[model samples]
Target chain A: MPNNALLLDGTKVAESIKETLKERIQALGEKGIVPCLATVLVGSDPSSATYVRMKGNACRRLGIGSRRVVLPENTTTEELVETIRELNEDPAVHGILLQHPVPASIDEREAFEAISIEKDVDGVTTLGYARTAFGLADFPSCTPAAILAIMKHYRIEAEGKHAVVIGRSPILGKPVSAMLLNENATVTTCHSRTRGLPDLVRLADIVVAAVGRPRFVQGDWLKPGAVVLDAGYNPGNVGDVDYEACLGKASAITPVPAGVGPVTIATLLKHTVEAAEKYGNR
Target chain B: MPNNALLLDGTKVAESIKETLKERIQALGEKGIVPCLATVLVGSDPSSATYVRMKGNACRRLGIGSRRVVLPENTTTEELVETIRELNEDPAVHGILLQHPVPASIDEREAFEAISIEKDVDGVTTLGYARTAFGLADFPSCTPAAILAIMKHYRIEAEGKHAVVIGRSPILGKPVSAMLLNENATVTTCHSRTRGLPDLVRLADIVVAAVGRPRFVQGDWLKPGAVVLDAGYNPGNVGDVDYEACLGKASAITPVPAGVGPVTIATLLKHTVEAAEKYGNR
Candidate 1:
C-alpha cells in the first residue's frame, strides 16, 4: 500500500503566524510600545533554563523585549510572588511567563496564581484558565492555542467530532479539551486513571496525545484515518505516538520536533504582542 | 420485570448534610458568631425572587443570618457590583449569592465576578470556577457540589467511570464534568453543538442531564444500569430526563423536585456555614 498520510506542517503554520505578528509588533513599535515578556525562573534546572532561553530568543526574533528573572534554588513562594508583583507593576513589561518546575519545595500553584491576569500571557493563572474555559480568553495556555492554530491553518473543523484527549494536565490536556469543547467538539478527557484506554482511543475521530509517555499510543489503538495530534515531545526526538507506526494509520499527524513546539513558541510571541496592544490601548 | 434500580435519595442525603451543618452552626454560635449569607437580587423577576427567598429561609433554618439586598428594576451593573462589594466588606456576611438572570441589560457575568472569592459561597466567580476545576476550591457552585455530595453520600465511586454530561452551562454541566474528571472518571462533555447525542449518552456508565429542556433525554439514550443525575428543573416540575423512562434503564437515579433541587439549597447553607467557620476563626 502507498503512503497517503498528510503531515500537519506545524512549522510552516508557525512561520505564517510569526509573519502576521511581525506586522503587529511593528505597529506597536510605531506607537512607542515594545511588547515585553518577563520570564521568571527559580533554581538551576538545566532544561528549564533552556526553555527560558528559547522563549527569550523567540521574543527577540519578533522584535519584542525580553526580561529574565533568575532566583536562587531555595527561593520561597513569598519571594517568588513578590518578584512577580514587581514585574506586574513595571509599566515596561506587558506579559509574564513563570517557568514551571519551580523548586518542588516551593508552592508552584501559588506562584503561578501570583501573575496578574492581564499580564498572564502564558495563561497560568486560575482566573486565566477560567476565562479560557468560558471562551473569553485572548491568551490561553500556549501549547493549546498552538494546537488550535494548526487546526485552523489546515481548515480542520472540530464541530461534531469525537475528540479523545489523552491527558488532563491543567496546562496542556485540560485547556485543550475545554477549547475543543467550546469549538463544538464532543470531547472526552482520559488520564492515567482511565481504564480500557485503547478502546476509548478507538472511538475517537480526533486523537490528542498529551499523556507525557513517549510513543505511548499504538497505531493499532487508533481508529483508521483518525487525525492524531501528538503534543507530547519526549526524549530522542520522539512523541507520544509512534511516528512511523502512526504514519500508516493516521490520515493526518503532527511530528514531534517541528510539530506543536515551534507553533507553541510562536503563540507565546503572538500573545505578548496582543498583551502589549491591549495594554497600550488601555 | 421487577425494577432493580436504586433511587439516589437526594433529600435524605441533604438532611444528613444539614444535620452535620447544624452542629457546626451551633459551635459558631457559642463563639458569638452567626454565619451570615447575603443575597443580592436585581429586579423583579418572580422566579428569581422565589429562589432568593427560599435560599434565605434555608439560611434562617440553619441559624445563619440572612440579608437581602433587593435593587429596583432599573439597577445597573455598577450598582449591583457596589451592593456585592458592600457585602464583601461586611464582616458579618460570610457568603454572597447573586440570583441569576439579572435583567438582560446588565452584565451578569461581571456582577458575578464582583463577589469576593471568600464570600462567593454560591461559587459564581471566574476564580471560583477555575479553583473548582483544579480541585482546590472550598465552595464550588451549589448544584454541582450537591451532585457530588449525593454521589459521595451513596458511596458511588466516580473513578474509572465513563460519565457523559449533557449541556455545557458554566454553572452546572461544565463544572460537574470538571469535578467528575478530577475524581478520576473518564468524562465526556456534550452540549447542543454535539452531534449524535444519543450515541454519546449510550456510552456512559454515568449520565448528567443539565440541558434545561423538559424530558429531553429518553431512556433508550442511556446505557443499561447507568447512574443518572438529573440537574435540570424545567417549568411544571418537569426535568431534562423522562423520569419514569430513565428509572427502567438506570441502576441509580436522582428524581426531579425531591432530588437535586432540595440538595442544592442545602449545599448553599452548608457553604455559608463553612465560610462563617473559616471567617470567624480567622
Candidate 2:
C-alpha cells in the first residue's frame, strides 16, 4: 500500500552490464581476439538507422569491434542473406545483429534464419528461439532477455506468479512469455484479437505491456499490486502502459525510454562478448 | 448444457483424413513418387515401440512406404544423429519421425535437429517448431496439429476465445499453445509452476489438458459449457482430465483412447503425403 512505486531503472543496469563486458572484452584482446559484432541494416528509415548506430556506439564503448553493413532499400532478400552469410563465415565477426522492420519487399524471417545460429547474438534465428524456449539459450532475444535481467537484478520472483504479456511478436512478446514460463511464471499471451483483454490483465500479478500501440494499457486494467514492465518504445516518448496512471497503482514499473530499451542494447553487446569468447576458444 | 457431451472422435477423423490421403498417394504412385516415411527409434522402450508401429501401420494403410531404423539402447547421440542424417539425404524418404523418449543416453534435441526441416513429418525439429509458431508450417508437431484439426472439424471457434493450455512440454504444451495463439485465441499456458491454476482454467472457453498426469485437470476447474480437448494418453486409457467428471460439465470433449492418439498418427501420415508432393515438384 505504499504511495511511491519502485522504479526499475534499466539505464543503470545496462551501464553496469556494459562495465562488466568491458573487462571481458579486454581479456579477449589479450588473447588476440577482438570481440566483433556485425550489424545489418536493409533500409534508411531514420529510426532503424538510429538503432543501428546506437548499437555500434555500445560496442565501441565496450572496446568491442563493430561493423555496420547498410544495404540499399531495394536490396533483395537473397542479397541480404548472402551478406549475412559472409559475416557468418568471417572469423572476426563473433556476433550478428539484423536491424528489424526491413523493407516490405524482403522476407525478414528468411534473412534472420540466414544468420548463423552460432553468431546470432541478437537471438533472431529460429534455432536460438528453440534454445531459449528450452532454457538452453546461448543468445536469447535481447529485449526479452534484458527484461528478465532487470527482473533478476531486482530479485523479482516469477515463480508461482501470473504474468500477462500483451502482443505476440515473435521476438518480444512470444519470447518473453517463454522466458517467464521458464522462470515458473504462469504466462498469458494476449494480442489484438484477444477478448476481454482488461479482465485478463487484471488477473495478472505481473503485467508486461509490449503491444506497440501507445498507452494501450490503462492503469485501471492492472491489478492494484501488480508489477509492471513496459517494453514499448512508441513515438513521442510514450509507452504501452500509461506511466502516470500506473505509477499510482502498480507496486513497481519500468519507464519506457530508460527501461527495456537501454537494457536491450546492453544484452546484445554482452552476447557479442560471450560469442567472441566461445568462438575464440573453439 | 446437455448432459451428453459430444465426443470429439479422433479415430473417425483420422480415418477420414487417411481416406483423402489414399487418393493422393495413388496419384503419386502413378508418377513414380512413392511417399516414404523413415522412423528412427532408439532403444527398446515398449511404449515407444508401440507408437512407432502405429505410425508405420498408418502409413502402410495409406499406401505410403515406411522405413524403420531401430538403434540400440546404448546408441550414442552422434550415432543416432548420423542415422537421421542419412534419412535426410535419402531421395525416397519424404518424412522422418524420431520416436520420443529416446534413451536418456542420447542428447535428444541434437538428434531431433538432425532431421531436416523438409522431412520433419513428426514436427519434432526446431525449424518445424519455428515454422509452426509463425503459421507457415509445412509439418507441425503431429499431436498439436491433430488437436487443431479436431477443433476445426467440430466447428469450435478459437478466434476471440480464451484458451487455457495446461502443460509446457516441447511437442505438446508449448507447440499447441503457439498454434492456438496463431489462430487468434488468447492463450494462457500453465504448468506445475502456475499459481491459481483452477481460477485461470475457469476463465477459459477452450481448455486443453496435456499435462500427462492422469486426471490431473479436475472437471470442476473448467467453466460450464467449455469445450475440452484432452491430449494425454496414459495407461488404462486415463487422460489429463478426469473424463467421467468432465463429460457432464463440458459442451464437447475428446475421450482418452478415441481422441488425440489416433488423430496424431493421421497427422503424421498427412504430412508425409504433403511433403512428398512438395518434394517431388522440387
Candidate 1 wrongly placed segments (more than 4 Å): A1-3
lDDT per residue (tens digit) for residues A1-282 in model 1: 736578999889999999999888998999899999999999999888999999999899879999999999999999999999999899999999999888898999999988988899998888889999999997899999999999899888999999999999989999999999999999999999999999999989899999999999998998898999999987777889988888888889999989988999999999999999998634
- Top model number, DockQ: 1
Clashing pairs in 1: none
Q: Tens-digit lDDT track for model 2 on A155-201? A: 99999999999989989998999999999999999999998999999
In model 2, which regions exceed 4 Å deviation? none
Models 1 onward score TM values of: 0.97, 0.97
Per-residue alpha-carbon lDDT of model 1 for B121-203, expressed as tens digits?
Answer: 99888789999999999999999999999899989899999999998888998899999999999999998888899998999
Model 1 CA RMSD to the hidden true structure, in angstroms: 1.6
How many clashes in each candidate? 0, 0
Give the per-residue lDDT of model 2 (tens digit) for B1-282: 448688999889888888889889989999999999998888899989988998888778778899999999999999998888888888999998899998888899999889888898888887778778878789989999999999988999899999999999989999999999999999999998887889999999999999889998888898999999999988888988999988999999999898988999889899999999999724
